[model samples]
Target chain A: MLPELLQGVDTGGLLVIQDSASYSGRHLLQSFINAALNREEAVHVLGFEVSEEELKDGLRGSPVQRLHFHNAYTDPLGWTDHPAFTVHQFCLGELTRLVKQTSHSKPATLVIDSLSWILRHVSTPDVCRTLQQLRKGGAVRSIIGLLHADMHQRGTVGSVCHSATSVITVEPAMRGDEAVAKITKRSKSGKVIQDEEIFRIKDDLTVVVQSKSSKGAKKADSEEQETDPTANLTFNLRLSDTEREAKQKLALPFVFSKEKKTALLHSGPGSGRIHYEPDANDDYDQEDPDDDLDV
Target chain B: MYTELNSILNTTPDSFTQGEFVLLSDRQSDASFLIHHFLSLYLRARCKVCFVGLVQSFNHYSAISQRLGVSLTQAKEKGQLVFLEGQKESLSVLIPQENDTGSQAMDFLRDPSVGLKNLYEFVRSAVSSNGEEGGDGSEEWGPPVLLVDDLSVLLSLGVSAGAVLDFSHYCRAIVCSQLQGNVVMLVRCDGEGEEDEGDDEGSERLMKGLTHQCSLTLHVQGLPTGYCRDIHGQVEVCWRRRQGDGQYTQKKLFQYKVHDKGASFFAPGTSSAVL
Candidate 1:
């Protein structure tokens, strides 16, 4: 998605990515940085939300030694002993001065991790003015400003969109797991062109631009159905009077029937006593005399 | 001074900690009292304080402190308080041109360009007590608590939203990472009265962005039900806790009330008065 968007980016061109919660701006930024580094173009990242170490960790193992960072998240005094990175005060003036100083070396591609942080401290106009300065500054051929659109006001977003030569909005697809990137506005050499594209992020953190396909949609639908077997099943809630009556008739009783009790024994001939036999047994027991032997 | 408020905040599962940003958003324009209460807590705890006044002047703050039974003069004398008058600068820059006569304009002539950078510089100097003219040796005091009276002043002064955001992010970073102190910023929700949808959206966006950055967000507003007329206002506090790298636990909401002296929190269902 980023490469497709940056295909024709030239000197003095500004690209803005409007991101939402469903989309990660860091991924897009990483991709842009990687692409720039692959071409051996100098890349300077003005990081506000993340530190330099974190940025390096994000681009771990990439051959991006020409990359430099202006970290605003750590070290409030904006002082750093690191050879490749410079810590900057969170002030726009300081940032502008640093950009100018760097531009003196050569025209580089500048990528701001986020503009949302800058917006919180200053007004929209100040941000726009700074971007304008960066664009006109000879040090950078192109500038990419990443903004969390969901975190900013509509007016702020609108103003940023107006300031950029091209605006790319990334959002989550409505039905699929893929993210969708749309080119809402693009201006090339005094000509304004608008195009929309859908894309997704792969596991390797690369953006794959996808074409619109009915087969893809069908596949997604089938996957959805496969995940949920009840996807195609529907139930009716309303029932006719007769059907209701039948359902009521089919209902079981709530209470169970009680069981009858039975007598243990009935009077009969076997129940009669045998008194004479007990008397004879008792006389016999008296003479047994196992109890007589005290020894 | 903020015994009640502190107790209420303490009851939260994730209480406010040092090096955290707390945003106090005023929906009823009564955040000053809460700020005063919190500042009193800081002072009582013997914590050094740096007060950045954006909407109120030094005198106004001093007077409020007096009313709240806090001695601003004593605090300053003891080197416990540092006050930066941002309200003056903000007003000088924000006031309409028609109201700025020759003399008033002359008053601002000596000052450098009024913007977020200057405000940040002022705050930095005010917070750091190193190498200043004072030699009382109180500069070695513990980390100072930061209280920004009104952040909305910057927005009203026409500083860009981006600048304000960046300024806030830096301030938070400084207080949390370098100073290892706590910062409470007061912002007025001015979008309530905005008739333009665009302006409303802009203000909402700004508020949302600030809220997202802060560790705790307390929204103070007038109660919807007039039944409890004795209650001055109500506060809805939301605490955000990071669970892991990209995961965050659900924000916890706490409701409380502002009274004559301090705030009182009600158990979840104790108050039948819907707000």
Candidate 2:
């Protein structure tokens, strides 16, 4: 719906995520690109900060030519490193230059995995200004990312939100020992208050399908293997089956501090299932034998 | 403004692969500054600069002609500057005896013999001649105009205000007749203040008259509260409109600026809508 909401805009729109930690921004961007890019020459994905080895391992068996790939760690000489040192560093001249280059390249889609890191490296005002420059320069059609911050007041979020066409906010909700994801759209006043949905993290990074009737069936998977040639639904091919999984995996280590258990999940191209393990923390206190001895 | 023009001209390559147009608008004084700046750059680039100033007074008219490096008689004869005043009382009484003698020597028709007819004839011939020459002579520069001040002053005195509008129509016609390049017209009026004194009927009449012309109008409203809240508070923007086909379109020939570099626009937050 975020892409549908941004249907008619000419220049690419902005998406700012303020949260400094958690890689939701990256996941959102991957999903947006996967949904938007289709034609052979229409889309280009330039990945910054990650290693070539990591990218190859992750994208194995996937079509890589459709994306104009870059790995900052691997291609250090040509790539612009993630300069998240300070607020000024994020809005560095280097960033502006990169925006100009990307615009000239003329891709239908542009993805900045995490806007939060840019904010961490630069002041809000500067970030806002840099976004204006990118918008004017004619970058891709939509720029989606994760925004993170320790605390974000309504007013602060509203101001930055003005630059964007649509915003979807995600949060972690607890249901017993498992972590559920809740998603909401931003209201007119910039508050995340509409169409709330709780989802379970099933397959590696698969998106939590919101509709109840379609909960069990993977939309892309169902559409891809439709036995009925005259199915009632008109399937959109752009949205891929592995897109949701790729989005989640892109935002690695999706951790929530309040949750008692932390899940570190990893999966590969041919792997049957991803492995999820609980991370231990100091919050759990051991029971003393003298205090409560039952044996 | 001239400094900016000079910088733009110098920095931008003379031969650009993409099309470019220098769109400009400003207040009266600022407009003058801008034209001067543009002319200097045009001259340096081997382009031409043309001026079209309308005058209603003899003394001020002569001064303007002098500043433009042209004599009063030549300006009238060449049809570059139009004298809107009529009759002997229209400053003919003060045409110094020495100038009269000099005018005759220079082949300028007698001031007393000249009427609006002479003015019309000169303009028609000048426009036609530009058309005949193919208008793109190596020495010929881009058509730049400076409408000195408002021509409405003449109409507001005794004639109907419609006369002022008529003058604007005529000016537009002349420019269109020999469209070589861009033309910048400067008009001064009571602006928003005069709108109230005219009453509803009069304002409606003016609006009706204006509706005939196809023009892009930008309303620059000032928000006093934001004057110092950030930096630039005064905002200027071209009003966008939808076409007959129901597609959103932007006016191609306009640009805007906020009063401060740090501010957005001046309109109240509520009345403004975001896309």
**Rounded to one decimal, what is candidate 2's iRMSD?**
29.2
DockQ of 2: 0.01
User: Which residue segments of model 2 deviate by more than 4 Å?
Assistant: A2-11, A17-25, A39-49, A52-62, A69-106, A151-158, A174-193, A199-208, A212-295, B1-275
TM-score of each predicted structure versus truth: 0.54, 0.29
Residue B59 miss distance in model 1 (angstroms): 7.0
Best by TM-score: 1
Task: Note the Cα lDDT for every prediction shown.
Answer: 0.65, 0.37
